[model samples]
Target: MKGISSYADTGRFEEISLASSSYSSILYDSIRDRPDFKAGLSEQAHLAAKFESEAKYSVLNGFSYISKHVNPHKKWGMLINLSSFAKDANLSLHRNCIYCSKAVDLNINAMVDNNYNTFYVAEKTEAGELGEDIAAMQQYPVTADTSVSTLLLSNIKQGERAIIVVPLKKKNFSHCMNFIHHAGDGIVVDGQQNKLYNFNNNADKKIFDSLYGAASSAIKPARIYITGKAPDIRNEAWEMIEHPYFPDNDWEEL
Candidate 1:
């Protein structure tokens, strides 16, 4: 008999046992079952084996395998080409990396002077729970407009460092939030707009406190920045920078 049309190889067909069904009902139920049940004749097992082999080799080459446990709907669980995953794996394998923790733990103070430092994190809200925007930044060096969904992704491409930002306090930041998040590590909040009096008055301390707090939270090394007058943090150990914005205000203080 001809195989189902949806099967990759329509000519292929698998044989099944009818021992569980009466001879009279065997043919009828076999025909009534779902297409996939009857379409199991293809070389799916062989294909899976081939994919596993490729996945292993890719891993040896610094590629990472993400188990499909996160989302089973995806066709493949292992994402081989993304540098972010590779970096995570590589960092974990480092002797001094401890437990191979996420880049979040790498000390920004030590890396502040390093030219290749590139990792950014941003706050992601979904269903009122914190999520990750790492995936979008992972596809950096984006080229060609794809869709509104990929707007963040299309703006970046591979071979570039990862950058993300999470605003601790403020609203009107969504417009430039993505840019800042992808620009570098750190927090950038509107002191004036958010009515962040303390932040405006103690920018440097706020910046230092932010990084110190993040590191204390078991987070990796991070860079913190603000867009207003900030007092200098005494004996500050992290990389902090001030980039003033919205200069129309007359209440300027260094």
Candidate 2:
């Protein structure tokens, strides 16, 4: 698990020990055995409702209206940000609370929109191994990890092509969970070393032409890269992850 950094020396956040891996049985056990896990999940749900209510109120009243007098927008934003951190804490338990679970090697990422303070978590899995049960967990009220939708945006420009590299190691991605609360832009890459998957950007191909040109000259190319404008790349990525279809199975709910 990743260490929780103190925010502005306020010391509001503290680290809790958690299970080490996200194997299926371990996830099941944590939900069953860990009182803290269930308690945190419930707390997260509570915060989600509060945050939603505040957001809905702000939308109806106008953020500018709140910002003008009491600055409730800032206050609510900070509260929402804190809830984001709380969600991370709860998610950590889900992913790494058990002592005997096997490590699942894969990557998952959430694309964020800074302007709207929104998160779009990618629905990544380990090559679909026993994934149906877990995928359905997102929809089941009892099993949903609320943090999936509460974290920070990547602070990306509306049209720029950005990549949040999600390595196989869970620790590497854990810290990124709180990127929004810390006011940081999560990893932005040019996609040089990482293979660009599902390209939807329409940028100049020369963006990567030089790098690939040099690589191909030294060795036969294993794959080709292309670019395009990904105006809705976030939506596309989410749709692919949340509604994954394996010809043999349909979308099953918990």
Candidate 3:
């Protein structure tokens, strides 16, 4: 009796009763006439009945208790801006720049000039903020070895035109295409060998229209170079704006 266990805890009593009911209705003469077996089955039927009654009361009480409380979804917001990107960029600076005495002074000016606007769907965490905080929450910085992806993200805004420079990395060709698709408004500048790639024909046409004017603009074409092949460094010549990759699907009206 100690080793033999009951089905009370496992909820199998109800299953056995259901099977008994089905068998009772079948044309199995031998199964229907078994009085001793039927008498033993009465214990399982009683357990199932008790379980159902308790389950009903528990469910009703649980629902009533839950209905008395307010269930509010939590909100989250992030203000990511150029400053954070610069902080991240500092980690990637060349060893020589890190050692130079002028590094601090240079980064200060770079930070000031690297201004860009980022407006995004606000999370509950961002509620009641204004001005700079509103703009900062939308910024996303680029990661190491992802300059092309970073640049493409920087150039795009929801429903706005952008001229992006794609950095050349033989390994990240697919990442570049994904960045283009996410932008929803970007055009490849011809004659830039470093950062160009093939996009889906249908998607490319849409990007062409988004960048129509600037695509034809007379401004000096932005050069994209494979990482190691970046041209000679000039003081304060390179400008960087980094932001997070926001998907059009997740976008909500501000």
lDDT of 1 by residue, 1-254 (tens): 11111111111112223243233322222111223221111122232343344333432111111111111211121222133325452211111011111111121211222222232111111101111111121211111221212232233332122222221211111111111122222222221121111222345334423322222222221111111111122342333222333221211111
Whole-model alpha-carbon lDDT for candidate 2: 0.20
The parts of candidate 1 lying over 4 Å away from their true place are 1-134, 138-187, 190-217, 220-254
lDDT of 2 at 40: 12
- In model 3, state the lDDT of residue 19: 27
What is candidate 3's lDDT per residue for 140-228, written digit by digit as tens? 22233233333453544422222122221211110111112222323232211112222224444443333221222122112111111
lDDT leaderboard ranking: 3, 1, 2
- Using all chains and alpha carbons, the TM-scores for the candidates as numbered come to 0.17, 0.18, 0.17
Pick the winner on lDDT between candidates 1 and 2: 1
Flag the better candidate by TM-score, 2 or 3.
2
Per-residue lDDT of 97 in model 2 = 10
* Local distance difference test, each candidate: 0.21, 0.20, 0.21
